[model samples]
Target: MRKRLQTKLSATLPPEQLKKIYNSFDIVGDIAIIKTATPNLENAETAANQIMVIHKNVKTVFAQSSPIKGDFRVRQLNLLAGENKTITLYKENGCQFRVDVEKCYFSPRLSHERARIADLVESGEVVVNMFAGVGCFSVIIAKKVSQTKVYSIDVNPTAFEYMQQNVKVNRVYGNVVPLLGDAKEVIQTKLQGIADRVLMPLPEKALEYLPYAIMALKPEGGWIHFYDFQHATREENPVEKTKTQVAQKLACIGTDYRFASSRVVRSTGPNWWQTVLDIQVSGKPSKF
Candidate 1:
């Protein structure tokens, strides 16, 4: 998609600025969002306009002017062209989600990851998603696997509202339970020891809430889909470092665990990567 957009943008932007356009852009429904540094803003505007022209489906174009930040993980957007609206319906894995881009956090990049985790779920397993932004992961799992029950919790009220709406939109209300408030508190009061699987997709707070995720799992222990951000040079392995830390933490919590798998989900920055570890935990420890 970037290649196609760039090919069309080349006609409007200078040769030197061609490569300046970031390779990554997001198309959430009818909106096209591009990230352009200050130096490349001019070219990005042209590209945004060109994008709408090339892709008739794109009715709006916005440049991501700031990094994803804040408790809600919303980014600052600069309108480049077309419609002023930010609300759209994003479809993924045969489920539909209505989202306000400026109010909630939804990433098309994680679509594959969501589906991957859903596929790993057994039919009767229960899942607790600590940072269930719009319940994308929860809804997908419920929609894909009929017997699974997912308790999706989010701190952001706007996200929670959208999550509830999405539950109805996708007809997964019976499968996914959307809750508003802090995940840690929710887990402590209502969700402890009920999950066969726990999802910690919020890397920013995943480590701090690690204990809660562990507590949510059954006494027999189960699976945890853990996400975290790690920085490493070319010589170091981020996944290994993360696994070691998590293993140490697990041992401290008296949970026997093994890293079933690990992979880089995306490059967050230079030498910084977002990684996921699929951990299998047992009630007692044994030497792996």
Candidate 2:
């Protein structure tokens, strides 16, 4: 889809500026979010206009002007063309989500990962998603499994608000509980020892809050869907490297864990890949 946009844009933008549109744009519902760092703002505006021309469904276009920074994980978006609004309705995996593109962190890229985790969930399972941004993972799990319960927690108030709306929008209702606060405090106060599965989808806090993720699990053991960013060379396998790193941490925390699956979710940059590890951790440890 992006390459088609590039070809469509060839007549309007120069080749050098075109390469800056390198990463392509993300079409979330009627919004087209340009995901690359263009050296010149004008080039991005031109590209955004060209994108709208190619994808008629897109109603808004914005260039990601900054990295996904701070606690909320939201990037600065420069409005390039189309509508000025940031809120849009996005659909995926037979579910609908209302997202505020600037205020919340919503990745269309993680759609596959969300579906993968939902497929692994069983009916009546208790799941706690420690970093459920807009309740993507949790809502999908709830929608997929009729009898499952999901506790979707996020520190960002806006994300949490959107999560609540998304739960209702998808009609998960009693299945998904949207909680607003830090994962550690939420797990410490209310969610400990009650989960059949836990998710650590936010890497910024994943390592620091890992113990809390484990604490949310049932005493016997449960699954941990851990996500992180790792750098690897051409010859190095990013998945194995991530497993080794996760293992070293688990060893110190004193948990017996077996990696059920590992994969490179996406390429964040050259040689830098976002990775995920499906680890089954057993036994509880005092170490935080």
Candidate 3:
């Protein structure tokens, strides 16, 4: 679909500028999010219109004006084509999520990651999703894994509201619990020492909140799925740097843990990798 849009856009855009257009776009529900750089932004709407013409399912096209930032992790968007609305129903892994793209941060890119984490969930295990946006990971796990419980925590009230609705829409009310507030605060106050597996999916703040995740695990030990973004040059290893950084943080707090595995989940940009560390925390649990 993107190629078709790009081909149609080539008539107006220069060949040098053609490479500036991103090849892939996010299709959430009926909305298509296409990002255009400043150089090629003049033709952004044209591309969006072409996308709408090429793809029958896409009803709304939004141009991402800025990077995802702030406490809510939402980006600024401009309607380039079709409807002006941003609220939409997204489906993934048989679970439904109602989200306002402008208010809540939802990524279709994490679909595989969500399913991967769900597949790792053992029956009867208690999982705590520290950054469950719209309860995507939590809901997917609850619907896919029977006898498992997930405590979905999010700081954004709007995201939390949608998360509650998503739980009902997907009918995973018995398995997924939605909590509002900061992950650390929520975990410390109500979810301490109850999780069998802790998911820190928010790469931006996962390391900062690692202690909370560690404290949320049972003293006997459990799993911590840690996510982070790292920059690596030609000589440095991004994943190793992440592990070392995580180890240093644990050491600072006098905590001991073992790394089960580390994987490069995806490449965010040139020489930048999004990594996940599967860590096993043992021995005495730390006090918040």
Candidate 4:
């Protein structure tokens, strides 16, 4: 179905425009997924304007500028919010995350999503964000989940430094540990015991980490937040595809698990969906 939709879209949209739209909405897991509409790519400004119309929830838009010698370089712009206020986001509710667009890799969508997740985390629980981008998830969780200990891991040094700063600024350094390295390597060598909740937000490649996520589960039970995208058929449900992926990965490691709950966290585009599957390992559920 996704392929069919893509074929139809390809006929109507310019190749460059189609590519841009695809890349724009190809939301990386661990980041926020925002809904976007098809844009008329004939005019660059018009296409951008169309995006602005449907994406009312987002106060910022990253626009593509001309490249070197008139090529295109994507640029971020602050959007207008209602009457007198320009959309400005501050580290709210003890969240110490700040994005240095000049030096740091940042995503407005991810930042907003982290804030939302932070609001949902409970105290005294252990949370691990596998792809902790700049500690956005880690800091927010630490700030909100006072009793919870968060281990945020990332392979990028620049991102790790910013994450450390965020933890300190939020005054949750005691609760959040900024680990600098790949999650695959760190999880095996450094982390022990099962986590109350594990966040696998790297949608593009999250399936590959399912085994590790299951292995890190807290014996009796724990929740794994799995995010990814898959092709769906008319008879196929996106949620079910995600479940199958999880199950297959677990089987690869000879582990069994059950879905506690599942829901579409957000939709990115036509046929392309971002779903989160909350799973509990087989057996009695543990009290976290």
Candidate 5:
């Protein structure tokens, strides 16, 4: 429903904790997911009830039980209110996504990020999403840009299953190709030099798979949408720091590239930010 559903809360939380907990309110499809690092809610159950009362369209509410961890990147959810189901249909950028919030990773916060990448895709381009969770980016890109072919890859079998269904749900079978395996291996064996553009959306694996991302691009070169996380104080620029680090690593590998776009996507923590770099890779990277 709503990414940030605002409402009046005074009794459950003090004035200090209200903003943090309120801002943490997130909804994917009809499921509302609440996540907060602070452990100071006076009446957590009451607050959960309040959400259901205020939002009639919310079919489910879950307290994010664990941090998004592991290779699968799935969130552990504890039912707080509403239906005891983790599956929902999330709509974004004129595209629909069928996702299991507990079994598969999905972020409503990245709705704009997804749209931004799709906008950069030119028609007839062949795209490869290195971390296409549930085929969101690939489906959206294929939907928005006509005549584009997207090879969607994911290692998680569960996510891949959902991805296959989502591609069908969206009716982009010809446009989006779902491949299940480790992206790096998949690229080396089958997808080398096949893409006009490549997307590395998973921040954790983006840097580790940088070389494979380069390999996926055409020899003449193409664009890469890279994501990473960086911590910066109020005085430091996280995006700049991330850019420098990536630049250094890419240089070590002799990957010729330049930034086409870069920005702080979101604040992951107090001083930490998730940054993205739209890099135009030239020629090719050194072979490992």
Candidate 6:
């Protein structure tokens, strides 16, 4: 069915727009599928342009291709239903990370949260990004915050390749080190008692890695941006859940810490919120 629709779109769209549209699909696969009765060439062009800009530094763009009736495509492209571009960031005040939308994979919301986390990091800080996808958080931090060295860990080879490219594109290749492996193992070996700030953006599995993150933090103090999704009903409290998890981890390690802050960074789905916890770790205080 998809192949048939692709054929029809090829026939219906103008050669130029068809090329662009086809290229968009080629990069993103069926992920960016559009459904429309009458294809809007102007809107398609705009979407293509946005993709090009987001993937400016990438060698290729990979997208899912689907046929859309003209009206829906027009509405989506014009931001009537909101933009469809992935969250590969391009510009920042301190550093820049040009996303290769085709090869790299990630949500736009995650990219924005990474940028915000980058802003909070300081120079010379030892930073570790667990589940670092295509080095989004690591590249942004290294590029923007001088003196900070980042250990970016990911299991995906494709994302690692783009991660390396992003480090160079952002001109922070020297500061950002890409580690291609499961963060659970890689972080344990490379970052024991060294990280000043840790980013755990893998919401679904971040809780499982809390022990490693706690062990990796500097003794005197450190911060963690632990990402997790939970229900956001009036009776639900994401922050409290995060605190409970942190307390459990602290108990397991027999270490003491205090919660600095927790804030909702983005919404993952209906009634689901993604939150970050800022924790400060310390040793037992001596009696006066």
* Per-prediction backbone clash count: 0, 0, 0, 7, 0, 23
> Which window of ten consecutive residues has the lowest lDDT sum in model 6?
71-80
Which residue segments of model 1 deviate by more than 4 Å? 14-16, 20-22, 284-288
Runs with alpha carbons beyond 4 Å of true place in candidate 6: 1-104, 284-288
Which candidate number has the best TM-score?
2
TM-score list, all predictions: 0.94, 0.96, 0.95, 0.67, 0.95, 0.66
User: Tens digit of lDDT per residue, candidate 3, span 1-288?
Assistant: 667767787897777656556454688999989755463556776677777888898899998888889989998888888989999998889888899999999889888888898998999999999999899999999998899999999999999999999999999997999999999899889998898999999999988998899889987879999999999998998999999999989987777789988998887767999999999888654544
Off by over 4 Å in 2: 1-3, 286-288
Cα lDDT, model 3, residue 47? 70
> Whole-model lDDT, candidate 6?
0.64
| lDDT score at residue 281, model 1, on the 0-100 scale | 83
| Residue 37 displacement (Å), model 4 | 12
RMSD for each model, in Å, please?
Answer: 2.4, 1.5, 1.7, 9.1, 2.0, 10.5
Per-residue accuracy of model 5 over 1-288 as CA lDDT, tens digit each: 233333456655676666666778787888888787643434445556677777877888777868899999987777777789988998998888888889998899998999998999999999999999899999999989999999999999888999999899888999999999999999999999988999999999888898899889999899999899998998999889878888988998898889988999999988989999999998977755
List ranges where model 4 is wrong by over 4 Å: 1-96, 101-105, 110-120, 233-235, 282-288
lDDT at 89 for candidate 1? Answer: 92
Give residue 274's lDDT in candidate 2 (0 to 100): 91
- Structure candidate 3, residue pairs in collision: none
lDDT of 4 at 284: 34
Q: How much is the lDDT of residue 116 in candidate 5?
A: 90
lDDT of 6 by residue, 1-288 (tens): 334434555645667666545543323321343323344655564544444444444332222333222311112222212254543555544555555443455444455676778889987999888778777778778877889989888777777877888788878866888988877788677777788988887777778887777667776658877877778687878778777876776676676677787888876546878888877767522220
Best by lDDT: 2
Backbone-clash count (model 6):
23
In model 3, the runs with Cα more than 4 Å from the true position are 285-288
